[model samples]
Target: MSGRQAVPSVRGKPGWLRRLDPLTKGIWLLCTGLAVMLTLSLTAQLLWYLVVLILAGTGAGWRLKQWRLFALWAMGFGLPLLLFQWLMLPVGGDEPLWQPFGSGGPALTASALELSAALTLRSMTLFASSIVYATTTEPRDVVVALTQQLRMPDKLAYAAAVALRFVPLLLAEAEQIRRAERLRRLTPVRGVGGRLQSARRMALAIVRSALRHVQDVSTAMEAKRFGSARARTHWRRVAISPAGWLFAAASIGAAAATLVYF
Candidate 1:
């Protein structure tokens, strides 16, 4: 099975974020992400991350449990990247701070730590922005906003939505495969080489399964005459309100100011 499932849906009562237009939310996320990418200071990225966290917590009502899994996943990758940066990216004139494996190993230095922190914090900022947008916005709303507000083709918007919706189903199918293997006592090899072979087999199985599912979905969509019409009508409409525009603009402006001045 894949180590993790896909995107999460909102639970319980809907919040204010649900009422806002998906396009506006998307713009806010994009602007912040760009600003975070351009900024060089760790402190600036940290501050932007805090702002995003607050919005996610207060407006989105994101609980600790929902975030815990994602945080662990982020740390799993981010920590290694951080270590790599610290060990390999330092300049020649950097002062040695500590040597983990005595004089034989590369010395940890202040410059390395600063560079690593900056890079990691920027990545974390982008992650937070994405999570907030994904958790709060519905796929249907996004499709509607894309088709109506952005002038996107109906075929493309709905296709993207279907692909996203397929993610969880694929994850579940992979998990089921793993469980069935375990039930049949089909243990793979014990050595590293054997593990790689086992992983390759599992991956191939998953790809085949996904291809089958995609074919089924494509057939179903074709049967429904999905793209026959020049224009499609939506059951729901999403339009940006005055408040949503104001909020998006403010968020983007704040990020730009911080990027330039901070």
Candidate 2:
């Protein structure tokens, strides 16, 4: 199988960022993530989105594909802003811009548009930042940084890594199985029978594949002497560079400025 797992080939430390520890990268991601989540300022949100969008091009190409998916997602989520602006405005405000209904309506003011823009930008930044971080950094590194630097529980970290790794594998495997089913069924179109039965088969296949993977990982771990008693070493090492430090500093500075100004 072209898709069969031999081993995961995660990229190594770039010459540019080999000096800083994983903890620093982790810290930068955390702080940026917090800013993405908590900030109400539009400028800060746009800055974070732009930084992460550029960073997305640096890593595995798979992560960049999420931008397409996120556009649809963000628009779907952002639609509520229009509704909120329509419903909540004109109730008490002096300035009114949009009147949706004849007379049973509220007014849409500039303030309402500003609030909507802020909320929408914040939501989009949060979504893009999350995808960028996940795509640029390996899940294992994230878990390791949490456990080693933040004193997160070892079991929790391990579980998180496994789950993240499992998602893409399962998705790929499901795609393969779906193709196989299509081939098996001699049809120009996917009928209800084909869709339902194929979905059921894919679910079972996913479960079996997951269980097998778990068993294999356990066996390999035991063979390598990994246990509750022994220290586990990661093959993929994540280190930050001077550029990463500058990036973090800029992100923090932006957040600070936004906080001070707002």
Give the clash total for candidate 2: 2
Residue 8 error for model 2, in Å? 16
- For each candidate, give its TM-score against the true structure: 0.79, 0.61
Q: Write the per-residue lDDT of candidate 1 for residues 111-206, one digit (tens) a residue.
A: 778878889878887877776776677788889988988899887888867765565455456666665666776565689897787668778889
Positional deviation of residue 199's Cα in model 1 after best superposition, in angstroms: 6.6
* Cα lDDT, all candidates: 0.76, 0.61
Tens digits of per-residue lDDT for model 2, 112-152: 77666766677666656554444345666767676766777
Q: Backbone collision count in every prediction?
A: 0, 2
Q: What is the lDDT of candidate 1?
A: 0.76
Per the 3 Å backbone cut-off, how many clashing residue pairs does candidate 1 have? 0
